[model samples]
Target: MCIIFLTSLLLSPARTHNLEEIISDCGTKLQTFSIVQMNYDYMFVYVNGEKMGLLEDGRLALYQRFPVGSVLYDPCELPPREVPILTDAAEYGVTACKLIPYGHYEAYIPEPTTGDLHPMTGENVCVYVTNLPPNTTAEMLGRYFEAFDMVAEADVFTAPSGECTGRGWVVFQDPSKLLMVPPVLEFFPRLFIYTSLSDKIPTRTTLQLSSVPEILVPGTDIASFAEPALNHNRSGNHRRMNGKASGNFLKISNAANAGVINASAYYFVALIRRDEVEKSVEEGVFWTNPANRRAFYATLERGPVIIIFLLQEYPVIFGYARLLPDGNADKNGFSACTVEWMKHHVFLKEQDMRNIPSVPISKMGDGVPLKPEIGESICQLAEQHPSHSTILERLGQSSPNNGRHVGRGAGVVISGNGNLGGFNSVGGGGLVHSVGDRGTLRSGIGITSLPQPLGARPATRGGHIMNNRIPQRRRPYNDNSNTYVGYGGGGGSVPPRKL
Candidate 1:
């Protein structure tokens, strides 16, 4: 019973030899000694101050025999806690040795923090760092530096939240702390990894910043001196360049017969085509509202009726027509008002035009009331075909002035010899009444010969084009019994009597 007890006592871990003695006895095998620390299920190894790798499974079995050179860390050196053990001999296995004094295993003892100098000041800043590896605390930073020199202020922004994202800035009262920065980066969770050196260190120049400047005080009422002359010049230039006056062409006037009353000019006649002229005439008669037809005819100076078709809507059809009272010069009449194409083709959004308001017929005098003539039809047409109502309304609203648009001219009309192409006159005149597009002169006949206009230089090229919008106008000729009809307008001069 005594022998068994002695054997048991000898095998007990408490009876193990001292660390220094065990390390000395191992001799050459002691050089291979290493420490393994438990990190959850896996254990990490440290040898010669370098971390090796994780221990594989089946390497953690307890109570295994080892060879003479085998190595294992003493549990006494570690904090009182559960320590994982290796079992698989062929893998993690090592020879067992009696414990030795920690001092004898000099390589295993952590070296004092050395070679760490303030990166900026090159000062010995080692004593400024404390509680380094396992439980590094913010208070340690303050205490450690306090031993070296006076610290005006010490602020340790501990990552109280969690592990930092691997970046931090520490400002010391002495600025010497900048020297001790690790070449390797430190990590903390949930923060961005800083790469640029400027981001880590604050500069003296940046610390001296200034506030923004104040707003200036309001001055005079600059709007009072607004000049209308400038506005007029600008508006006139816009009218000349951007508006309807920009589109100009020559036209043909009456060339129907030898002695027919033809008076349209030559330059005007040479531009337009005979087919367009014919279509305009036909649509003018056919599409004229019956109610306004007679009054329109009576207002003509010498012709039966002034057939004006709104060419804006293609397939030029007669639009809502109104009579021109002999003495009515005021813009109270629709003919006196000019059409202003919007800068953008936006839908009309005015209030009065929105509702189905009543318009009196008596307001029209002898001609049909402009509103009654097209209002109901327009509304009904819009209801059925919303896509085309505005176009129709714009067409109905258009009217011809002498030869120009009511407010905008630079356009002309010809009727006497409306010959745009037919060789009736030296310049051009024909048998149709036609008005040209803006910046042009027109007459209904056929382009006979193009004559240079007054103050107008001859075009470098020939072939006078009649309509500005439809740049192309070439059609096969038919008989004059069927008058060629063309409908076009611009604000300018009047054409001859008839086509």
Candidate 2:
């Protein structure tokens, strides 16, 4: 429940993040409001009176927005509880944000009322930081430094010309915390992570996902991006010379890069085949490793949406499904649990996953660990599907099919090229949702193109994948070394392609 005091707000030009989702879920049901604007802006966050670090435009999530020329913040105007720093992302849950950069005031943490002494170590520690980006707030510096130790307060310096010098001092609670910092401070440039390890992957100054997806070829509007952008970490195998990538022909798009994934939500990966997906989604269960029950179930406690890296062709990311955390092991030592498959499946190919370094593609079975950014990007890109980001279980509520989904759910007429609406599903339910000449919403499982519906037969409760006798192309089984022999067309298996 977001508490937005819109009565005193002066309507003007601005933008919002995840506002439609918020309003659709709970906002509209409680109060009547409209968008402040839909443009680029800045965002800040505070947690328990402590402000966090600044990343490039981390303003992708917001409850309510402020006008362009309004007060950025006024802590004195309201009680302390009224303000929360929640502008970072939705996955972190609670947040309080200052709207725009107008009439800028302190959205920083308050100075300690106690004496200048550590609560425990009884020592004062302050580290000077330089080469900071423009308008680097003390709160952001404090948040960044807290990675090494307990930050008490942060102070920034201003130049003689009254402009910020991009230099600041981080005050830590304990002097011992300095030991945790890198010994070679001189090597840290603009805070880039240039370690002593030779095999380390190069990184960009900004540690956030690039808002814009990279294009591979010139004058080609193909559905792809030249990933490994600043925020993205493509595979180490792909080398960059003068910003021209030699390998890893990756693809991403402006639409895919749009803020979609809930950074606060957890994401897991399941390396399963496409044929088994419908059965699992129908049965509301997915299986995982048996040895590390804690590793799989403990992480799912955060409600991670399991990404299905379908073992078809080049092992592309086929679907996105959410699993209930309460999973139990079977008699033979395998784990399984109920699942809620996202209406639209994720279809990122090998190049896409390799380019997306945050996606642990090599991880086997159902234990692919994904960072918040990767999960967020995957979720955002899933919205581009024809399903319009509908959930299977929720959509199936409108029509009953004896405890089964009704052909990828009905579609609504949404603006755009109308390229992503449901087609005549395999078992048509007489509920049509076609808009314009948009393509079919099928996952392209057996056939090359669309116009064919997926088989939606009821699934039986069991641990093993049901043998439906569906003639699926053989899945390439990769070994621990990432080297595998591809099946040949002439019946003779091709030798393992040397990596």
Candidate 3:
């Protein structure tokens, strides 16, 4: 019975060997060791300690022929794998280590705090940062934290004067990476970083309408500058001519054709605040209130309308836009709408806004309440379609010639009897003339004189052949020459050919 009791005691975990005794046995081979106190009576053991893969009741297991070095730990002769520090506090009871400021605002290790070795809560890991550079912005702080790990959000507090207050908070998506904060602070050495396990990270306020610059608002036309020297003519006849002119001799005008102009379309100006413009420029998004949208829809009822932007003191004409029956509203309750340009329109937030020029339009008479005119329609149409002159100019481009000849038909010919005729399909190129016949030319290869008889002689002015039967030399054909000669059959002298 006593032998059985001794055997039972030998196998019991409570009677296991001491850690110091195990280290002594290991001697110089014992690089490092750690004890994880599981309960008052039992503990886990590790050599060359690591956070994982530890052996429980290690001394009892070793006595039962458990292999040495089978429960592996990092073999490198370094500090503890979890917290790399060697101190008396670590030997005592402290498991986690933190570096705090010492007497001269320098770095020093304090007694380990009592808590879970890794007390990571499943909340957003945030760190409050102080003593930041005066010029640091929220975007800059966010970018700085992004180098360490994925940051959820960052915000830097600012003074009333728009200067940074040297205070900010950064929230990380990974709670495990929060341990990197102390090392990062130590690396910087100039800043103070406090880690927190709360999700109350600071956020900036959204841009508001009042924050927009006043310059973006449309302005009223007041009396100041003199009237323009030339005014646009409304009459279609003289529309091209800017000033009053009588004759069409010069015909110098800017008149547009009637086909393209949409006479029924109305015109209106929409005002976009500076903040909205900036947002649109940056994110391609712009929003309007229901009242303004309704007004825009009303103008569209007449026909397609021209939308002008009242930018600062000038009236810059933007492109046109049509209203949709239903549109989605953003979280801020601003409905989504599209503005059309020459090519296409894109969704405000989901697409890109086209870059267009800001051309200023002239105001009409004072207190005239800017109304639609034929000139506006003409201008809009001109923008939509190319000018008639431009079409003609494109058609007038010179074509290349590779020495190929083109002709409608055989050319007209004047006969020797003062009659006009055309080349007919004779054996030779003899022009057929009729006194009162409607003349038309027939297509032929080339012009040739009628084949003369083999022994034909030259005729004299007296209707008699010369005594010598001399063969007359035919004239060489000159395509470009305007002169034409005809031979008289009888005694009638061939009338001189006239152009």
lDDT of 3: 0.33
TM-score per candidate, in order?
A: 0.15, 0.29, 0.20
lDDT of 1 at 99: 21
TM-score of 3: 0.20
- Report the Cα lDDT for residue 475, model 3: 66
- Please identify model 3 stretches exceeding 4 Å from their true place: 1-124, 183-499
Report RMSD for candidate 2: 27.8
In order of TM-score, best first, we have 2, 3, 1
lDDT winner between 2 and 3, please give it: 2
Q: Which candidate is the best by TM-score?
A: 2
Candidate 2 C-alpha lDDT tens digits along 307-402:
433432223455666655553445323555555666435455435544433432222223433433455355454444344232233222222322
TM-score of 2: 0.29
Residue 353, candidate 2: how far off, in angstroms? 9.3
Q: Candidate 1: RMSD over Cα atoms? A: 38.7
